[model samples]
Target: MRARLDAESRAAGFVSTGVCRPDAVPDIAAHLSTFVDAGRHGQMAWMAERMAWRGDPAALWPEARSVVMLAHSYAPQHDPLSDLDRREQGAISVYAQGRDYHDVVKKALKRVARWMVAEAGCEVKVFVDTAPVMEKPLAQAAGLGWQGKHTNLLSRKFGNWVFLGAIFTTLELEVDAPEAEHCGSCRKCLDICPTDAFPAPFQLDARRCISYLTIEHRGPVDADLRPALGNRIYGCDDCLAVCPWNKFAVEASDMRYHGPHRAPDLADLAQLDDAGFRARFSGSPIKRIGRDRMVRNVCYAIGNSGAAHLKPVVQDLCEDDDATVADAARWAVERL
Candidate 1:
């Protein structure tokens, strides 16, 4: 049953798959409590709201006997950090460069779950990152990979550029041994962060994280941290890009996930209205941030760009309807 499931998962476009009991993540509750209690999650109040389900998969679905974890790699062929040097361009994270992973990964999860049900005669439920399930720990427990010092899963086979999905089923399958941590003495990921978001190894303070500031965070960002944002207008991938384990990563099989959107011109992005923003990022994850938030990010990047040519664009945005966007634009104009 396990072997058949593995083959089905690969056919469904997942690069790696493994299984573990629903109750496999024993220390997740404690770890989560510590992280949240320390206010490390920043303004992501949803994490605190779903504490029970997020920490314990068994609690989420008591009927489930096993959890099958799957990983879909989206590694880039070129250097992910190379865009940082192009100060006039806005650096969007590699993950959001193409179609939204939520839509893509969810479709693949449904395919795998349907196969498991038809072949093994078992009831199943599929989950992507949208759910409160602790996917990384479950993946590590299933031998998919270990959580590196950056706190993201890292696999010898797929590196740090994989999207995780899961299938919970009533059928008990043979479980694989957990992958042991291989970070050793490496602190490359920790050192590369522009904002020093990491309080220590394997922990993150999301308040200072560029990804959180540009994406999940609402309202005005701190003036001091805005300068460090550089040209990254969307999510930041500094830690992930600097990881030594990424040497084993392969180019993504999904062609839709690779292209010029990786580094859009900051000036061009600054001129987008609400409708234009929607049309430009129709199928992309960047759409989730909405026009105002995205413009706010672009303004920050423009400020960091130091390109006098973008001063007019920034000055025009200073009268934006959205207060946050206007604030960011004013900040950018001052910098220019």
Candidate 2:
């Protein structure tokens, strides 16, 4: 039954999996404290709560006997660097360009979890990013991939483009051995960060991370960092894009992950109203940020676009009811 699930995941394009023993839950808890104590998670205050449960999978769901970690590759089809020079266009991270990964990955995980339950007659629970599960650490311990210096997991087969998810079951499936660090002396992902988001190897400061600012941050972005954002209106991909190991990566298997909307125009995004934004980003992760935060992002792009014609767009945004959008729009207007 485990072999069948492995085959199914392999056929679906995931290259890694591992079953971590329930005892290893303590190791995950200990590592998580190091991250939280160091203040690397930024304003994600929830990480500080329920420390005991989040660190150990056994505590999260005492019924679980094994964890089946899964990774899906969403590597970009074309060179991401090509879009860097197109200042007037928005460069969304490849993962967020199409359907929300949580929806795609969760549906697939349910199938695998069901297969396990049928074979063993045991309970199962699946988790993606939404849960407090330390997926990267668990995946690393389970041998899905080594957590690279940028603190994101990197697979030998998929490089830095793999999206991680997990399924915990009461069934005791065969566990795979953990993988060893393969990063060696490479520091490209660290050196390429525009905001220097990484505080040290394998640790990230979310406040300086464009992905956090654009997606997780609720209000006005730091005025100082707006110019550094460049034209990346969505999640920033500089760290993932700069990884040298990505040369071995393959295009995504899911067709929903590809198409023209993969890269949208900055000017067009700036013009999206609440209704338009809702219709355009429906079923995509971008929709979760809502039109206001997205417009706040587009305003930053307009500032970096260097197109005087976009000045009107910024001016309009300055009058927006949301203080966050209006604040960003004023900053953008000044820059343009």
Candidate 3:
């Protein structure tokens, strides 16, 4: 069954797969509570909402005996941070540069999950990032990877750029031994963070994370973190980009959302209305942030840009109906 699981997962475009008992990660609840109690999850209230189901995947569906974890690669072919210098262009995270990963990964998961039920005559449930499942911890428990010092999964084979999907099944399979931490003395991922999002090794403060601020964060970002945001309009990948294991990352052939193209123009992005924003990001993960949040992020980038010519672009947004957008626009004009 494990051999067939690997073969099917590969055919479905996943780089790797592993199985573990639903209760493999015993400490997940403890870890989650600590992060939330410290108020480190920031504005992501959902993290605190599903404490029971999220902290215990076994409780999510009591009948499930085993969890199948999969890794899909989206490793970049070029330096993700190279665009930080392109002041005029908005630097989108590589993951959002192509098709929405939730769509792509969930479709593949459903495909393989259907196969699992048919072959094994067992009930199965599937989940992607949007679920309460703690995939990073589950993935590590399944032996696919380890949660690195930066608190993102780091795979020896696929590096830091892989997406995780999970399957819970009644058909118990032989579980693999969990992977051990290989990060060693490497502080590269930790030190590269522009906002020092990691409060300690193997710990992340989402409040200070650029990815959280640009995506999950609501309204205007804290004033101090605004400048460090630079031109990142969607999400930030500085920590992922600096991992030493990435040297071994296979640039995914099937994942080609990002390329050698220069960054998208920030001035152009700041000018987008809701309709234009939706059209531009129709199949993108960026669409979820909505135009107001996206433009608000762009306003911060524009302020950091020091591109005097773009003053008028942001000036037009100073009166945007969205209070956050208007405030950000005013801030950008002042910074200029």
Candidate 4:
């Protein structure tokens, strides 16, 4: 059954798979409590909500005896760091450059789960970073990969770029051996951080993280962090790109996730109104940030660009209806 499960999952586009008991990570509850108590999650109150289910997968669904953790590859063909040097263009994270991974990965997870139901007669539920599931620790516990010093999954075979999804099942599947951390004094992911988001070897302060600042954060970012943002208008990927294990990453078979949004011109992005923003990113994950936040981020990027020629582009937005957008525009003009 396990071998057949692997074959079906691979056929459904999963790059890797592992099974583990729901309580595989006994320390997860404590680890989560510590992070939340410290407020490192910043504005993400959802992380604080449903603490019990987030802390313990077993408690989430007591009938589930095993968790089938899966990894769907989205590795970039080109080095994402190279996009940073395109100062006049916005550097979207490699993950966001393509279609939304949530939609893609969840669809694939459902397919795998459906097959398991038919073949093994097990009841299952699927989650793709949806709900309160903390997938990275569970992935490590299922032998998918270890949570590296950067606090993100780092797979030896697929690197740090795989999207994680979970399958909760009632079957008593044999569990895989948990993977151990292999960071080994490597500081590449740590040293390359533009915002110094990591306070320790295996911890992240999301408040100072650029990805959090650009995406999850609402309103004006700390003035101090704006310059470091450079042209990364959406999510940031510095830590993931710098991981040593990325050398082994295989290219994603799904072309929808590779090169659609690479480095769009900052000037072009700065002109988007609410309707334009919706239309442009209609099917993409970038749409979630909305026009106001996206334009605000673009203003910051333009300010860091030092491309004085683009001043007129943001100058038109100096009195945007959204106060945050207007403030960021004024800030950009001053910087230029």
Task: Candidate 2: list runs displaced more than 4 Å.
Answer: none
* Pairs with steric clashes in candidate 1: none
* Candidate 2 structure quality by residue, lDDT tens digits, 1-336: 678878877765566667886566467677778878988777778888877778777788988888889887788777776676788888787888888888888887887777777877889898989887888878887888788998898877778887888888888888888888888998998999988998888878888999898888888888888888888878888888888778777677676776456568877887888999999998898899899999899898889889999898789878888888888889889988
The digit string of per-residue lDDT tens for model 3 on 1-336 reads 889989999999998899899999999999999999999998888889999999999899999999999998888877989989899899989888888888889999999999998899999999988789999999999999999998999888889899899999999899999999999998998899999988889999999999999999998899999999999988888999999899778667365456322378887788888999999888888889899999999999999998999999999999999999999999999999
Kindly report which residue stretches of model 4 are placed more than 4 angstroms away from their true locations once superposed: none
Q: lDDT value for candidate 4?
A: 0.92
Query: Alpha carbon lDDT of residue 211, candidate 3?
Result: 94
Residue 206, candidate 3: Cα error in Å is 0.6
Using lDDT as the yardstick, the better of models 2 and 3 is 3
Find the 10 residues in a row with the least total lDDT in model 3: 253-262
Q: In model 3, where do residues sit more than 4 Å from their true spots?
A: 259-262
Measured by lDDT, the strongest candidate is 4
TM-score between candidate 2 and the true structure: 0.95
Model 4 TM-score, all chains together: 0.99
Candidates in order: C-alpha RMSD to true structure: 1.0, 1.7, 1.4, 0.8
Q: Any idea what lDDT model 3 has?
A: 0.90
